[model samples]
Target: MVLAVRKSVEWGITAAKLFVRRECRILSTLPEKQEYAEKQIERAPSGRKSITKKSILESRHIYPEFLPDPNPNWRNSLREKLEREDMLKRRGQVEIPEFYVGSVLAVTISDPHAQSKTNKFVGICIERKGCGLRADFTLRNVVDHQGVEVRYDLYDPTIQKIQVLRLEKRLDDKLLYLRDSLPEYSTFPFDMDQEILPEGSEVPVNPIQVVLKPKPWVERWERQELKGIANIEEYLTEKNKIKRELRKTPWEKYDLMKQYRKTIPIEDQKEIWTEVYTQLHQLQSAQKKMSRKRVFTSPKSLLA
Candidate 1:
């Protein structure tokens, strides 16, 4: 029994010594591996320093219509080229200033029925969609307690002028929900003064949350998961909330194919912007010059 015990003790000591040697070997190799990793990181290019400027990338937002239809089946290169040529020609004639969904605008259109031979409508932009020549926007307003909406083609020849009274974006891309909320949210004065943003300043986003009315909304607001609405839960019942949860397709956002189909490729966008940037820049410069002249020439009110 003593000899058996001695043999067991010797085996245990040998196992422990092997474990210690293996651990020491791993520890000794770690510093070399870490130094190699550090050298590789130093050799890699700095992404932040090599990145493109925001101004260069903003062309996609500023000239969205220039991008062709994302649907590959509807794309025709020759037709798109012709449409772009015509769109540029129209832009040369009319100065359509930068505006977004929440922006208040005054649109003057030629109308033979009106006494002045033109009619003006001031409203907040609710939606802007379509691509190329088919691009259009909807404006919403409340006039004399009546909610009114007007859709205008971006390249319409009848449009005499489009003045941006309030140049700001909303939290949501489309403000159609405003129709069910309240008329006050869409109302604007006809003689609203223009608000000018400082040069080189980023466009301001309105973070206002809208309160929705009770049930019977045009859309299923609960299922949409809108970010700009505050009181959506007040209108949702337990059953409605259950239905919303069941209808949710959270995985759709992760579908790479769906996203690719919905957006123009970056290479294609770069090519399109390269073709139109010079003309667009020149037009913007001319608009600035004309605006400056108007400001200086306008009669100033004498202070009392």
Candidate 2:
């Protein structure tokens, strides 16, 4: 979906084209603050061994895979501030509808590999995951008797448009189990067109439960503690129990340094939340203004 957008508004066409140029972006924003934790070294009060405060201080910063990915170098604070402002502006220009997992959506991504012109994929949103600038959603739909799922970075320039056919959340964050579930849970019309929820109207929630795969699931099924999966206890084999026990790191609790090596620090959290809250306020104000305009047009739009 290459947007051949030409605008006279960017002083001239060159600036507008430059404005929409594709820029590199990172997938996640975790693991950085983990590297900056202040760790303390232990020693006897006054022993022959002696206590020394070295500048290195044990150098204990390690990362785990499960944590969100890292932010990219090209990721600029000023640019992000501007991007958020633009998203707000775009919402006013076109209604940016609300959506959640289990919502069937028709997402149009700008694929350079696409043949002809527009490249689009329509599927049911199985997973709505990630946060901050990297937040993304996944769509699962079976096409041509084959199952297919695609994940899209919400704010990626590669995304031409996202149209919600059904906007709702599921019982779980990830519906990967839909892979083996019944066809109805994962099926969507191949030629299904987009649906528009009425402007400023309530986006309907679909509380559908999806069935999971049987025993020997791909993920740590027991630890994750999924509800949608039927009779997990029955699936728990003796070997699975041993694997779970072996996988557990009892020392991890006593390991303050280990825990310190795996998370964002207090200062970073303060900075992130400060920006998040400020942005949320801005979004709220914009929504309120949009609501007021709608109410002015029709008092009934707000609610009886």
Candidate 3:
């Protein structure tokens, strides 16, 4: 009977020890499990929030080309994301200035035919078309009594420089009529000096309206409702003038979605500019520093 009692006591002691060991294990793991649970809870909310700046949103208007094409058929959010990444990468390698249709530009391009393996062309920007990677521009100037216009792709790898000699806008979005205009209006000296505007000033709009030569234009100027031509009626026949009045779509200005379809939504624009803002800001800062250094180092007589 005593032996049975001792065995029972020993078994009771072993069970108590096992119970304590299990409790200790649970107690020891409690903090870690709690920590892991808290981490997951914290992480769940992290992915929901993103930061954007008002300045970046406002500044997107200055770089409209950075936004993806807004055509529904051509626009894929995934594709836009990839294209924006590629564009930002390209911008990091080269300097592209803010310019308008009327801005005078000098572009240096790698040319195999040139003796120096490069060629520089200077002219007034008559048009800027397309968007994203396909963005292109046309420069018009009179060379050797003949009109010369060069259309350049903004993102072409062979382009070495794009210097905005005069940063300004024109009355019209396109100056293609300059092709048919008098030679004096389209002519700009190839060696013309860059015109720098005052600091913190808005780009001035050249209010000069061009006068077109008599008939045989690339397009019917009368039918297009162009505002930049002063002598359009001189070239238009009475029948053509009547047709232009009949073709006018006065209601198009009120079509909100039509304009919206041509441009990225404000919300999407905010997101894109936010993503690339830091990189662009850094580049601008570097450029400012370089310009300041040049001003300080340049000879006073030369600067004057």
Rank list by lDDT: 1, 3, 2
TM-score of each: 0.79, 0.50, 0.76
Which candidate wins on lDDT?
1
Query: 1-304, model 1: which lDDT tens digit per residue?
Result: 9999999999768745754554222211011222435544643675554333223445667777788888899998888889989999999999988887888899999999999999999999999988899999999989999989999999999999998877777877788899888667777889776766666665667778878878688988777777789889887889998999999999985555465577776566666777787888899999988876653222222110
For candidate 2, give the lDDT: 0.52
lDDT of each: 0.76, 0.52, 0.71
User: RMSD of each candidate?
Assistant: 16.4, 19.1, 21.8
Between prediction 2 and prediction 3, which has the larger TM-score? 3
Per residue, candidate 3 scores C-alpha lDDT tens digits across 1-304 of 9999999999868746754553222211011222435444654555433222434654544565676666688878787778777777777777887788888899999999999999999998997877678888999999999999899998888899988877777777788889888888888777766666656666666667788998788888787777778988776788997888899999985554465455565567667777788888887777666555543221121112
Pick out the ten consecutive residues of candidate 1 with the lowest summed lDDT: 24-33
Work out how many backbone clashes candidate 1 has.
Answer: 0
Q: Give the TM-score of candidate 1.
A: 0.79
Candidate 2 runs further than 4 Å off? 1-96, 112-115, 130-133, 191-207, 241-304
Give the better candidate number (1 or 3) by TM-score.
Answer: 1
